[model samples]
Each structure stands twice: as C-alpha cells, then as structure tokens.
Target chain A: MRCQQVRRAWLEPELSAKARRHMQACPACQREWELNRRLNEAFSGWEVERPLPAEWDRRLQQRIATARTGWRGWLESWRWRPHPQPLRLAAGALLLLLVAGAGLYVRPRWFSPRAVKPASTGIVRDLQALNQNQEILQCPLFAGHGAGDLANGAENMN
Target chain B: MVIEDRLTGRLKLSADVLDADAEQMLRFQAGDETAFEILVQRYRRPLSGYMDRMLQNSPVSDELTQEAFLRVYLSRRRYRPTARFSTWLYRIATRLALNYLRDHRHERRQLSLDQPSPVTERPPEAASPAPGQEGEMLADERCRRIRRSVAALPERQRTAVILHKYQEMDYRAIGETLQISVNATKSLLFRAYETLRRELRDLEEAR
Candidate 1:
C-alpha cells in the first residue's frame, strides 16, 4: 500500500491486518504511524486557558436589556396595547357619518320620481283635437257620422 | 400572586422532569424570561471556548457567542422540542462563526490590533529554563506550534478539527451542524488530521 493510504488507515479506529503488516515492513509507514500517534496524543492532552471576562454578566445583561427595548419589545407592546372606549366611539361615529353621507348623495340619483304620461290620456287628447278639427273627420270611415258618432266610435275603440 | 407562584412551581417541576435544556427553552417560549438566562449561563463557557478555538480571537468569540444567545432569545417563539438543544445551539453558533469568517476574512487581521503585543517579555516558565524545565518549555513551544498549525488550516478543515477534537462531537452531530453528510464529515476530519500531522511532524521528531 502507498504510505499515504497506510497513514490514513492508521488514523482510523481499527487498522486492517494488511495495513499492520505494511507498517511493520515499511519504515516510512511506521514513521507515519508514530506521527499520527503523537498527534493524537497531543490533541488529547491539549489544554486551553479560558477565563471568563470580568464584565461578562454585565455585558450580557445590557445586551438582553437592549434586545427587550428594541423592535421586538415594540412589536409585543403594540400587540397588547389596550383599545380605549373613546377611540371605539369615535370610529363608530365616523362610520355612521360615512353611511349617511353616501345615502344622501345617492338617494336622488337612484330613487327620484319620473315625469310619466299615461297611454290612455295621450289617446284621449289626440281624439279631442281630431273632433275639434272637422276636416280630419271627413275621411270615408266617418263619412256619415257626426261628431257625436265619432265620439261614440272613439269611446267604443277605447 | 399566589396563582403566579403555583404556576411557577409547576413549571419548575416540569422543567426538572424533562431534558434540562429543552425544558428551559420551553419555559422561555411560555414567557418565562428567567429561563433564558439559565440557558445562557449553561452554554456561555463552552460556546465561547468553541468560538475562540474556531476564530483564534477571544474578543470576536465573545461577541459571536453573545450574538448566538441573542438569536436564540429572538427565536424562542419558533423553537420546537424535537431535537437536542445543544445541537440546535451549536448549529446557530457554527453558522454565525462561518458567516463571520467568510465576510471578515480580511477584517480578521484587525481583530488583534487592539491587544498588547506579546513580544516584550517572556514569562518565567519560558525564560532561563532549569535542567528539568527544558522539557516543559519544549512542550509549551510544541503546543504553541501545534496551535499555529491548526490555525493555518483551511477554514473547513479547521472547523472539522475543532468540532471533532475540541468539541468531542460525533461525526453525525458534526455533519448535522455543518449541513453535510456523515461520510463528508469523516473525510473533512481525515484531511484535517493529515494536514495537522504534516505540519507538526517536526515537533514529533524533536522529541
């Protein structure tokens, strides 16, 4: 096996028998094994000196307080803000005024009375005008009829 | 006030019965703000250490750690109890670290500008070594060299090493935090170890 492969295999939790044999026969692979072992040992024994800062708690508290007072606090407060009686009353009055104004503006246009002429009155006016003008009764249909007969005929037609 | 005390007592009892971290998170979700402080106190040290190792800057680590906690607080309402709290917490921290590393690669050099440089004097342990102290100095030097070597690694490899070695996280959990598969996590760790071994091989020979 290549020394790189052997080195990688050595780092694994379980080394194969072939790799073990290679490590034994190959001095380079053995050195690689030793290096890997040393590295692991160093890692296992690695220590860090990490002391918390003196103002850690204070800084954190300040950060939390800032967060509480920032946008999130504003949003939460807005969500839970109380709606007062005066505001509700004002809103209702505004809605009622809007409805009244709309009805007043639209009523004349929608429901106004129209000047309507009856069909019978128009026919009666035309017949009376024809009776007053005897020339229009000189037609053959009224040849032997007087104004009385014409009126009687007109009534019958009606 | 009596009812409030009874409710708090019930919450505390339930929190004690369940997974501590998840229970605290649930309490925070239920509007118990004090429960969030408990979580912050629990994770502060480990998370700060992890960030320091990952970024190699104490101040940046501190800021990122606090930001991670703040993000947790902001997301309390959306939290679910389906997963381990540490896993979720680490996921947030890792993401923040990775993003900071990516955006601030150039700015990283400036992180140490404010700190006093270490070149003025050596500590007694490092200076005028006694016969028996030679080995101790060598060990300290080797450790410093190892830290430099680890820091010199590429970002992904260094993350893999820090998560696997320093954090003692399993391949599965590391994969989950890194948003990669188990095999990918293994490969990353192997490559990282290989690099570390190559970089620190001279230290082994010096011994």
Candidate 2:
C-alpha cells in the first residue's frame, strides 16, 4: 500500500496486519511510517503545563449560584402570576354559586301557584279602585252644582 | 456487606462514578446545592486541561471552563442521563472554547510561555548528506517540526487532531461533542491528518 493509504488506515488497528506486510516490501512507505510515528510521539509530548488559576472554583461557584438564582427567580415569577388552574377553579365556583342563587330566587316565578294568583288579584283590585274613583268623580256630590244634573244623568251614566 | 467494603467498591468501580455523576446531575436538577459542588470538584482539572488545549490560552481557558460549568449548572433541569456526565460537560466546554476562539479571532496568537523554552532559538533542520546517527538526529528534528506544523493547522483540524490523539475519544463521542455527523467527524480527522502530513513534508524530507 502507498504511504497515504497506510496513514489513513493506521487509525483502525484492524488494518495494522495488512499495513505491516505492505510496509516490509515498500521502502518509501516505511520511511513515511517512521516519520508519521515520530511526529505523533512529538506532538503528544507537547504537554500543556499550566494549572487552573486559584480563584476559578470560587468564580465558577458564584456563577452557578447566579444561574441558580436566576432560574428560581423565573419560576417564582410564574408562581406569583395568577395561575390559570386556581383562577379558573375560583371563577367557575363563583359562576356556579351565582347560578344556583338565581335559580332559588326565581323558583317562585316559575313554580309558585300563589304567586300567579296574587299578581292577578293585585291587578284586579287596582282596576276596581280605578273604576270606583271614576264613579265618585262622576257623582255630583264630588264637585259643584251638578247634583241635579247627576240624578238626571245617573240613569244614562250606566 | 460492610459499609467500608461498600464504599471501597463504589470508589473502585469506574462505572459507579459514571452512575454517581448521573445521580449528582439529577440531584442538582432537584435543587441540591452540594451536588453542584461535587460535580465541580470532580471535573475541574480534566476539564481545565481539555479547555486549555481547546482554547490554547490558560487564563481564557480558565475563565471559559468556569463559564461552562456555570452553564451546566444553569441547565441542570435540562440534563438527561442518557450519556455520561463527563461527556456532556466536555461537550459544553468544547463549544464554549470554540466560541471563545471565534470571538477572539482578531487577537494576535499569544503563547503564554512562562519562561524561556529549552530550545529557544534552534534553527530549522536541513536535509543532510551524512548517514546513520544523522538519521536519528534528523528524525528528532522532524518530530519537533511536525508538532509545530500540526499546531499551525486551522482550528477545526487542530481540535479534531487533539481530540483524536490526546483525548482518545472515539469518532462517535467526538461527533456528539462537535455536533456533527460521525462520518463528518472521521472526515475532519482525515483532513487534519492529510494537512499534517503535507505540512510536515520538511520533516519527511529530513528523514
């Protein structure tokens, strides 16, 4: 195999057996392999020597706290805002009570027999009182000198 | 079993740590403050080193590592235990580091080399005519040149190479962390290796 092909296949260890056989016969491929292996080792050795700063943990903790607080604050805001669940329940209960009370208050209008009779009686009495007042007003005794006119008019007044 | 044995067992099993990490995340989601602290202490160093390589700057890596952890904490409620917690955490750190690099693109490349490097002013190696020992010396010089060359690669390739070689993460894990397809992850590694091979031609010639 060519060096390029060998390098590509090197990442997969299963191909190592085939690559080794090919590398033995191929001098150019051997040189490329050696160079790549050496390069890999050197690159791996370029260690990052620095440690994390002293205050990093403290700062990270503070940030964590801030974020936690922010999240809680958001949830708390939602909680304080009128929850639709409770609001709907309360409104429904109120509507139910108002309907019930109205039903009780108006039951007599539909179901009370005496209510019908009293209304008719009161209207009839008002009508009779009106007729009586009309008769008295027409009587000559109620006003000026129409007494003779009234007795004369009484037979026709009916 | 005794408590001591149980504790020892728990500590000994690496898988238990994975489970514990997942549990800690759950606790954190449930508003456990101490769980967050445990998580921070558990991952601080490995994450720091990983971030250092990703960002290639110590202080910035430090800052961003903290930011990544904080982000993880803030997103605790979103955590799912399907993947390992470290994998998830590293994913966050990698993304934050990549963003940092993108944001700081205009800044000059600054090596936080604390003191004089051992081989400060070493001249470039030439392809020499001599034989045996010269071959070894040339090989050494080639290796150094290769490191410098790989480090000079574009950020994505560099990251792919670093994760593949240094972190020893598989293509699947890398894909998840990079938010790319597994095939794309392999392609990234392939391209990175191709670039490294081409760029290190000097080292190849020296041999």
Candidate 3:
C-alpha cells in the first residue's frame, strides 16, 4: 500500500476504503483492530463507586479557609506599614533626630542667658564688697585729721 | 429557612457563579478566595478519578490530583478561557501527571496479586442477566486480569484510553484535555486499545 494512502486512512479511519481492505488482508492490522475494540469495551466499564475520602474534603476546606485569612491579614498589616520607601522613612526619621540633637547642643553656646547671668552677678558682688572695705579704711583716716584740726582750733582759741 | 435549604441555597448560588467560568476565574484572579474553593470543589473528584485511572496507584493519584488543583488555583491569574473551563482544568491535571510520570521513570511497584484471589468483585456496569448469579469467582478473576493489563499499558496510551473510554470524552475533548491534535488523540486511543486487547486475549477468548 502507498504510504500516503496508509497515512490518509490512518487519519480518517472511517473514510478509508483501502484501510478496511488492508485490515482484512493484514493479520497484524486485524489483531490491532480487535485489540482496540476489546480495550475500549474493557475500559469503558472501568467504574469505581467509591466516595471521595472525607479527610480530603476537610483538608481542602481548611486550606482554602487558611489561605483566605492569610491573604486578608497580610493586606491589613501592609496597610499599617509605612508607605513607599521604608529606607527613605528611616532616613528622614534619623535626619530629624540629628537636627534636634544639634540644636540642643548649640543652644547653650549661642543663647544661654542663665549661664551669663550667674557670672555677672558674682563679679558685681565682689566689686561692691571691695568698695565697702576701702570706704571704711578711708573714713577712719579722714575723721582723725578733722578731729585734730578742731582740737587745734580750740587750743588756739584758749 | 431550614439549615439544609440555606446550605443548598448557598451551594446552588455558588455553582451558578462558578458555572460562569471566565467570570469566576476572573474573580479568582482578583483575589476572591471563595472563587478558588468553588473551582477546586467542582473539579477535585472528577480530576482525581482521571488521575487514579492514569496513575493506577491510589496515593500517587490523590497527591497529583491535589497538586493539579493547587496549580490551577495558583495560576488562575493566567487563565484566558481560550477553551472550555474543563479542558483547561484537565490540561493542568494532564501536565502534572505527565511530569510526575516522567520524573519517576522507574516502574510503579504495585501490590502483587500473588496470593489467593480475594472475593470476586464485579464491576458495577456488568449487570449479569441474573443479578444473583453475577458475582462469581470467574468474573472477579477477569476483573483482576483486566486491571493488571490496563496498568501495564504505556502511560500515554493508558491515559488516552481512559479519557476516551472511561471519561466518555469525544476525540476533540480528549485532544483538548491532552493538548494534542484530534488525530493524535484517536491514534493514542487506537494504540492503547490494541495493546490491551493483545494483553487480555486469553480472557476474551475464554469468555
């Protein structure tokens, strides 16, 4: 038989007249045909009335439920998490903290009224004490001279 | 409403929503988890049965069936509904089964029927004219031999035969499920049946 005829008959078994003749004459083809028919009959009756295992149903349900919950929970947690770029968020926070610390450190150097006021107060107190001491010493010296002058006038008058 | 009615309502509504194929899958793609469950529930048993027939091993079939459903659920976002939903679902299952069979190239070790035959278990469809006389020792032996012969066919042939014969899918549907041309699907079925017939020739001749 021509290969094209054989191939064509192979594709459309119902349409091929030559293939039917070939099967009748060819022992191999007849056996092949019988085998195909019998296997079809045998497998067509392959039935099992077994029920689905209850455990499998339970497992599938549990898995689906867990998946549902897990997906929702992940979405919820994602909402609370900072948006866009976490590295940028952390960098911004760090920048804010550094700026605040530098301000605290430099504030004393630039504008500490309390630090200057205490030193000025101590200098003023020391100056006032020294002037009082000088006045007391000078007052005794000047009074002694004036009293002697008055006594000298009284003696001259007498 | 009664509890049963309420549950039934829910199931019916769910089935309706699921029967909306591309729409339900779209919902799944949009992260509707219930849509995924509905898909899984609708598909699991039939797909499992198909896998069981293909693998001929219950545990492996069970695992592969679960994997197939999971893959479908996970890949719902990629669904285009280019063909029927069932064809797409079976395509996923067929790929998983084929991959597994490929990975485990060694012959599957099945429990030998070496011991004395268990009680005769006739297939349900074989309703003998006298139902009472049907469950005989000979029929059970035949079922065993036939089962062994089916298990022995090459994987593709076995799958094609089971899908065509047992699943009752026509050539186009089988081709859709197997991701092959209709002609290839028919050829696979033809070869499978031919192999099985040769294997069980004695049984047929005896009958």
Candidate 4:
C-alpha cells in the first residue's frame, strides 16, 4: 500500500492486512499509530466531573411533563432557543420573501399597480396614530430637536 | 433483534445491543416508560461526557444532556426505527452541541475539563508508558497538550475527532451522526488528526 492509502486506513476500526504490513515499516505511520494510541488512552482515562443540583432529575421530569401538555409546553420551550440564529434569520427572510413574492405575483393579476390607492397603507395608519399622540406632540424636547422632521417623515410615508 | 427499514425492507445489521436499543426505543414509543429509562441509564453518562468535551462546559453539558433526552422523549412518536438508536441519539447530541456552540460563539466557555483525577483506576498495563511520579507528570503534561490541541481544532473537525477518538465510533456511525458520507468522515478525521499531529509533534518526539 502506498503511504496515502496507509494513512487513510490507519484510523479505521480494523486495518487491512496490506495497510497493517505497511504501517510496521513506515516511520510516519508509526508516529500516527503511537499518537492514536496515546489519544485513546488519555480519552479513556479522562473524566469530566460536572456536578448538577440534586433536583436535576425532578426538574427534567417536570420539564418533560410540562412539554407534553398544552400552552405551558410552548412557554417551557421558549425558555431555551436551541435553534441557530442564522437558520431562524433565514427562515424569517424566506417567509418575508415568500410574502413579498406572492404579493408581487398576485398584485398584477388582482389589481393594477396604478389603480390601487396608497391611502390604506399601514404607515398611513401609523402616521394618523402618531398625528394623534398627544404627549409626543406636547413634549418640549420633541419640538426642540427636529421632531418635526420625524413627523414630516411619517407624514411622507403616509 | 433485526430491524428492517420500512422504506427499503433491508436488514439493518447493527450490533445486538444497538438492535436492543432500537427495540427499547420502540417500546418507549409504545408507552413503556421503563424502556425509555433503560435508554437513559445507558446513554446519560456517555452523552454527558460527549457534550462536556464538545462544549467544554460541564454544567451546561449536563443540563443539555438532559435536554437532549427530553428532546428524544418529546419526539418519541415521530422517531422511526430506521437507524440505530445510538446513531440517532448521537445525531441529536451533535446537533445540540453545535447549536450551543453557535448560540454562545461570542461567550467564552467555562471549562471544567482536565480536572485532577486518578488515572490509575484501571489495572496497570504491562506496556504502560508511565509508572512512577515522573511518568505521571509526563502523562499529565501529555494529556493537557492533547486536550488543548483537540480544543483548538475547528468546530466540525473537533467534533469528528472527538467522535472518532473518544467515542470510538466507527466511520459509518460517525458519518450518520454528522450527516456526512463515510468518505467525508474519513477526510474530516484525516484533516483533524493532521492538525493534531502538527500541534503535538513535540510530545510525539518526546515519546
């Protein structure tokens, strides 16, 4: 066996006869075998002592029981978000894209872009609400720091 | 015990214990709590050790091992006995470990590994490399280096190395857990060991 084949097969659970024969002669394969042996021994001898609270089993059972029920199950799961952020973000983005894509695909068939009026937008509704926020309008600092620009921007979006 | 994949109807030649584990899983799915307990009793320590090494966080690993089992419990009905129980369990454990790593990538793990423990629990080997105090010191240093070297590997590589080296998983089982092909598993182990060899060259030489 060539060194390449020998190196690749060295880590297998069982070595082939040819590879085993080759390993005996090759200095590099010898080092690899030694390192592998040492690593195995170290791992076998190693122990991780992580002490848990006495009630761990109880808490786990409670969590599992709670998880099997209704709304409490949802609440329990919300405590630990094990899913990765990128996947969540991608899913969110995909949903957004899907909604946008569906809207784009459906809009032209349902109503002409020019025919649909912009008066019903959520931004317009928000601007109407902002237009009615009494405390926001009454604040002195709201007037001092270009809060009018904010109001204007909201109005423009509307 | 023989398990045939429903989709293919091919015999799954897993070991007798693994087949037994699959049977236990099936029994748990059939509403046997004792079967699930059996599985838990068997896997808890190994999974805890695996998660601890993966995250380098002892408390979190313990907590997460419970969560992993809980996940298995929650998804019991959904589980098909198409795979070996251990492989499927490791798949869940690996995903949880990787997800934990991703979630806390910014935070430094509080490592509780390499604690001072007696390594002489087992009977001494006739070919034991170390026997006396000097050998013990050397052994300690070697172990420390090994841990650090393993910890320093890239995430997937670290996982593959740990699964292969520590878990003693065969390539097929590891590939299934990592959701990679067996060839890919071999390549991953190769790269990981190459990196380890580079890291521990001095230790190798000292030996």
User: Mind giving the per-residue lDDT tens digits that candidate 4 earns over B40-97?
Assistant: 8898878877887887666778788988999888777566666788999999989998
- What C-alpha lDDT values do all the predictions have? 0.74, 0.69, 0.64, 0.74
Residues A1-158 of candidate 2: C-alpha lDDT, one tens digit per residue: 67667767766657777788888888877766665676686666656666567777777767666765786535533342222467757877899999999999999888876534455578899999999977887786667645577687788988
RMSD of each: 13.5, 14.5, 19.4, 16.4
On DockQ, the stronger of 1 and 2 is 2
Candidate 4 docking classification? incorrect
Alpha-carbon deviation at A18 in model 1, angstroms: 4.3
Query: What C-alpha lDDT, on a 0 to 100 scale, does residue A94 get in candidate 3?
Result: 95
By TM-score, the better pick of 3 and 4 is 4
Residue A126 CA error for candidate 1 (Å)? Answer: 54
Return the lDDT, model 3, position A49: 44
TM-score of each: 0.64, 0.61, 0.55, 0.64
DockQ of each: 0.15, 0.18, 0.08, 0.15
- The residue-by-residue lDDT of candidate 2 on B181-203, one tens digit each, is 88888788877876776656654
How does residue A124 of candidate 4 score in lDDT? 89
Flag clash pairs in model 3: none
* lDDT (10s digit) by residue, model 3, range A22-88: 7667776666556555554555455654556778867655654565468743453334332336775
